[model samples]
Target: MVLHVFHGAGYERERVYAARVMFEEFLGLEIALHAGQEAGWRIVRGEEEDGKELRLADVLFRTPQGEWLTEKAMPSRPVPRWHTGGHPVKAPLVAPDVPVLYGEEVPNGGYLAVWDGGLQIGADLLGGAFWMLTRYEEIVRKERDVRGRYPAFASLAVQEHFYERPVVNEYLEILWWALRALWPDLERKKRRFTPRLSHDVDWPLMGAGRPFFQTVKRAAGDALRRRSAQAAVRRLGGWWRAAAHGDYDGDPYNTFDHLMEWSEQQGLRSAFYLIADHSGAGEVDGDYSLEEPWVRRLMRRIKERGHEIGLHPSYETYRDPRRLRREFDRLRLVCAEEGIEQERWGGRQHFLRWEAPGTWQAWEEAGLDYDSTLSFAERPGFRCGVCYEYPVFNLLTGEELKLRERPLIVMEQTVLHRQYLGLDPWEAWVLIDRLRTRCRLFDGEFSMLWHNSQLVDQGETDLYRRLVETM
Candidate 1:
């Protein structure tokens, strides 16, 4: 069925984007946008019935003077304060107490007003969804953390303490509630809760390529800095075993088997984003090389066991389209040699460093299928404001790209790293649990990144096993 969206003039880019996401991606409906003299937005069914028109407010990007995309159009500080409706929009439409982020505050509480013929949604939820899906704030707000990523603290969701909530999904849910109430016959694309698992193979093996003396040095580091006697002994044991029988399983960091085993039992596919090559210092690409014999063996094993191999584009490649392309080609070449083939290849950026549309554009140019790299390293939860994978739109270019975004919702280091959230294991699980619950609320995909290197601790490993079971 066709849904004709009549929207206000100006910000054609913004209006089209919002409509496309709400109607096509979110509602699973064919949609077309038409500019109207009306102040707000309206969606009319192609075939008129009693439940024909669904009116929604167009409160955002509607400047009194001329246009949007200026400094004036950005969400103000203390952003996303509620605009409630006269009648309560309850569970399934929105989790209780969830407030409208962007809309006019009316006596109707500004969420929705049910009438005899149809419903009038007071919230500019489509516009709010657009603001989030495009990451409108990341472009206008020029503040970046030391790592050159837009800090989560600066984001509207986090600034207003709604990062844990999937605002876009909530907005979509409200839209669906209205749409379904209006068009009971309309059906949305079926979806199920999926655990999108990935392992960024940052540090593959502990002693695969290192000399014996270097292994001793690492053992010392494990004891002194890492404060793990078991890790130290395991490091030495792995080194000696590699020397004696070429077995590296004693290496605590050699957790690929453990990772694969759990996923295999759960009947889930795990993606390993490999570093194709490194051009910078600090092991930005990875400590291990793809050319290593053991690395190639691991790649072959992953494919043999039915896991995936994807590119972990080097640190500097985010801006360098040429570098990204070259690294992807190298990954493909190595995969070809290893006799590994995947229907689609996608991965995260190393260190979670990304520059909105530019990085997305590079991925599109490189011909990757999707990227799971939009989560904040400093905090977890709804960085893209939705858990489902959706086709990306480049705000700068005023065009959409085929490279979909399966947004990274949780990463191990983001929660466990001492300099980051630094939460204890139980605390980390609590936070991740809430996020997963929210994703499940919408039947959305929960994209999680757990590095093979970080699973060394037995306690953390146990936690992951539990996570896999529950997920």
Candidate 2:
């Protein structure tokens, strides 16, 4: 079935393309866009006509003097502070006739107006989805944290207190209901939702690449920080065991074997993003070389065990195509030398440093199949306003990139690190469960990033084990 959309003449090409993606690719609809007026279902930028016309348009679209409806138009509306299943939402639709997923009370004139014959939503869902899917706020909001990363607080979702909610999915649901009401034969693609577990091996080994003095210094620092001589002694003993006996089972950061065993027992597969290049000073890349014998052996073992050995592009290559190509090429060469043949490869950016179309362009040029780096460093939630994996689009050029973005829902550091939420293991598990439920509700993939180094800690490791078992 073809759903014709009649849009205003002044609409931007990028916005139109984004709407097409949301409707066609995401919402599973065949859409045909028309410049002016059309016959069937219509979407206009003005007041609705008094007739049996099935139309959907936001009141902001009727702006007498603006290029298009934007966040500026939202201020005039009664911004209601609302929550849906513990996820914050703003400007909720509250028309008594319109069925809302979650809200407080039905307002006199809700954002969405439903009737027996037609429906009219007072908000531009297409534009809103475009703004979020393209990361428009990141480009417009010129605020960055110490690491030159966009802080979650600086995001429109956070400012509007909806950071934890997947508003795009909510909008899609609204659209789905409206369309189904208008056309009962509408069909949608369905898939089983599951967690896509991944690990970023930022520090593969704590003592393998460090100097002897540095190892001792680390032990001393641990002793002082933890206020326990026993912890220091254990650290030194683990180093000695790894160095002399080639045993790393006791090493705090050496949890590869444990992870493999746990995954096997739980009947789940995971991807390990191995660092391909070393970083310069003031970077967060791994210290050990990818060519190290132990590293190569681990890669081979991971491949043999049916787990993926993906590349973890260094911090410096986040935006540099040349650097990213060099790193990816080196990783491919190493994998080839190890006799590992991967049909397609995927990975995430080190430190999660990404810069819009440039980063997507670099990944496309480098020929990476997919990337899972679109999550907040300071908070664990839906970063792209959705929970599903979708192909990325270059917001500037209005071209779809070859790379698929597996939206990351949670990262271990974002939840437990002192610099982030600093939640205890139980609290973190609760938050993870909540996010996972949202993914399940939408039949979306729940992508998670758990660093291999974090597994060395007993509490963190136990939490991961429990999560896998429950899943």
Candidate 3:
């Protein structure tokens, strides 16, 4: 099978080259070149056309008798071996310098190992010569040092890619090539990847029917209706409390009774995040020391109603590591008094204020199981730059921490935020639908955030609940 590398949208060519180098080193092998191009190889046609376009990588040899040939192509293959041997790869090792601009953190240095803005070179074209050489050296060392056991595979088990929007096609081709070289049998047997639809909603009935004319007609009607209602609401004001929860306001959703009732109806164990002293003035303190009886009653009722309680780790705590520890300490004590033995497993930073590496360190130190504050409210996409929850290395200590980050892909304010795409609830929902299309690209979890206060009945919050109900 021919290998192909497809980069994601808008990936820079230089970055692609760098990624190729890393991959080649991880896998110990020489990529056969297309005869004509001479610059890099690409597998175009069949074996006869090999070396012509530098099309495909030479991963294995197969004889006419259907027996697999060794890399050395001996009459009889030697017994299969593990890794060809090598030393453990250290962090911050940069590939040979090219003209490309690197991100602030060196490879494996910064909080994020992969940023989406990197470039991509065709897998067979630019090739991965440098990386292959490094791996070979490492392999030879392993063979010399270890008395027994070679690496089962020549390269790293996992591969990572970071690219922009436009070059995803090229990225895919490169992935196909890499997979072929690393796992020939697995690659040949597996089917190509396809995006899947995740969220469920009524579309055709909600005026999303066919034809350009129909969409335009419905959009115009919606615009007019919205404008008339906005004008009437401007003339007569209602409760403006909901709008105040923007940035400074904390724990503004006082609808504990309503939430408890709704959660019971749905049989969902919902978690309510409470900010400690940072909560707005006049709000009751629910910490361990001054456990107000009413607040305890609310927590008890919530438990009885089959919901969960969590802390909305305040924004200030993210920078001050101590704050995070203390806040979690207080939360645990409160939960203890309530006799809830199950340790809390959820966290979302207040205001989404976070530094990736620091936030992770804080979470690890606090013994938190998951952090759900990775996404930004201004952008409705992968905030940690990765779509899945995988154990990440600590940027400061280079330790592989065990905490998981559940990326929040969508948030209410993210849609209405004026800085980026200023989409109303309806507009935001449309964007969310587009994100849903991307979710099918991988099996990663799709996380969404909506504050309880944002759903309150107010002119500004007119369409928030409707959008949520649609979800």
Best candidate according to lDDT: 1
- What are the root-mean-square deviations of the candidates from the true structure over C-alphas? 2.1, 5.2, 19.4
Candidate 3: TM-score? Answer: 0.48
Q: TM-score of model 2 relative to the true fold?
A: 0.86
TM-score between model 1 and native: 0.94
* Clash count per candidate: 7, 0, 52
- Give each model a TM-score: 0.94, 0.86, 0.48
lDDT ranking, best first = 1, 2, 3
Badly placed stretches (over 4 Å) of model 3 are 1-252, 256-269, 279-290, 417-421, 458-471
- Ranking of all candidate structures by their TM-score, best first: 1, 2, 3
lDDT of 1 by residue, 141-240 (tens): 8999877899988887887788888888887877787778777888987889999899998888776557878788878998999898888887787777
Give the 10-residue window scoring lowest on summed lDDT in candidate 2: 87-96
* Model 3 residue 341 lDDT score: 56
Candidate 1 — which pairs collide? 84-109, 84-110, 85-108, 85-109, 85-110, 86-108, 86-109
| lDDT by residue (tens digit), candidate 3, 343-428 | 54566777666653667778888888777775544456643433444454453353556676666667666676565557766677
